[model samples]
Target: MEKNPAVAFNQPNHLPVCDWLNRAIDQGLNERTAPLARALMRVQEQLTWRYGYERMRPGLARKYAYAELLGSNGPVISENLILSVVLFAPKHIP
Candidate 1:
């Protein structure tokens, strides 16, 4: 089994993050466990919500983003690392 490619939404890529995750699910990338795929779906939603709010109000975005990063929505962890990086993300970044 091949390892899954890292999901990178900020970088210019062929597929948007949501599409990429859906495709992976459709391809049974997480066949070993349906939970994994579902977890990823949740991650996708969290990212979408976080980024969306981020554009409107960074303070508001931080609420959802921080929760998502802390895995308040699911069993996923490690988003804290991503949040850490986001904390220092450039103001000009989109």
Candidate 2:
């Protein structure tokens, strides 16, 4: 990197970001997680609605690029983190 800064998006790497993402998603993630897909779709839809389509599109793309650059493509944690968070919510009684 220090010697070849152009290696970030260079010819040797045919799919730098895509390959990285594919490798990350390849591990442990079951592509058939329907409920999780629906939940993510809802979250994306809400963001699209609130931020407007054009703005959200570019912003989401930017986020993807940012995550790719940072190599933050780990296993999906929505089901684990989100479900756990919701489950532990304070129980109220009248």
Leading candidate by lDDT: 1
lDDT of 1 at 24: 56
Alpha-carbon local distance difference test for all models = 0.37, 0.26
Provide the lDDT at 41 for model 2. 37
Clashing pairs in 1: none
Q: Give the lowest summed-lDDT range of ten residues in model 2.
A: 81-90
Residues 1-94 of candidate 2 have per-residue lDDT tens digits of 1232221221112211232333333331566755544544343212211111344443243223221111112122122221110111112311
Q: Candidate 1 residues 1-94, lDDT tens each? A: 1143234333122212233345555554547757755765555544433343425453443232322333323223333333321222223424
TM-scores for all candidates? 0.29, 0.20
Q: Which ten residues in a row have the lowest lDDT in candidate 1?
A: 10-19
Candidate 2 residue pairs that clash: none
